[model samples]
Target: MKFTFFTALILLFAPLTSYSLSQISNPNYDPELAEKLGADDYGMKSYILVILKTGENTSINKEMRSNAFVGHMKNINKLVDQKKLIVAGPFGKNNNDFRGIFILDVSSIDEANLLLETDPAIKEKYLKAELYPWYGSAALSEYLESSDKIWKVNP
Candidate 1:
């Protein structure tokens, strides 16, 4: 009887030992913000997925892909100077699902779309861009810094 009682007591106390400092007494923990923050600094970073849909089973050659990349880089550089794009690059592997990915700090989806629409690659049917809102630990900090300006640019 005593052994069974002790076993139950041990089990009850075991969970308490596993919690670290982060799990307790974090007054800065904002439930709303915490839920939004992802593993990456997604909140401060806007994720754009560029899907290249040329045609059915039509693969873009290396030279064409390289040209498309150059076009994207040129436009992305412009946006970056305008404080829109943060980072842009093609996915390391050719997964065929997406042509590339870009991280930006734009105000809204419409703004992002507008910028994307101007890309030669998109205009030439080389790619289509999809924008998704992201959140992360440092996102709130970044957002606070730029609070004077609106972040959402959708119409």
Candidate 2:
């Protein structure tokens, strides 16, 4: 009976104790900004990280492949404009089959998969997407404004 009561107390308080320990007062903490960015108490939120890999469809004609990738880039721009994609970039030449990545500002794998379907590269099997849940700073989207200014050439 005593052990059960002690265990209950520990379980009840553990989350509050850990939460308090993890929270450090920040001088620059802005509640309004955090709320606008959909941040949690930690100023972080869930996202779907998609790793694009080379697909098995090697028989596709060069023109079809080119067209698919063109659609892919356009779809990326569209997603960024819609604020659904926070980050998207291709990996440099590497031994791994990874072709690119997209950090999608979505909560569920289902939502990410739906968004990815808009990309012709993934739909046409030119690229395969592997999705994982990611936790990142909610402020990540803020970088896009500056990124648009600095990019002299559109990729």
Best candidate, TM-score-wise? 2
Q: Write the per-residue lDDT of candidate 2 for residues 8-107, one digit (tens) a residue.
A: 9999999999998997899999999999999998899999999999987796499999999999999999999999999999999989899999999999
Taking all chains together, each candidate's TM-score versus the true structure is: 0.48, 0.85
What's the residue-level lDDT of 14 in candidate 2? 100
Model 2 bad stretches (over 4 Å):
1-23
Top model by lDDT, which number? 2
Per-candidate local distance difference test: 0.59, 0.94
lDDT of 1 by residue, 74-124 (tens): 887687667566556566555566656666555577777887887767765
Please estimate how well model 2 matches the true structure, expressed as its whole-model Cα lDDT: 0.94
Model 1 steric clash pairs: 43-135, 43-136, 107-151, 107-153, 108-153
Q: What is model 1's C-alpha RMSD?
A: 9.6
lDDT of 1: 0.59
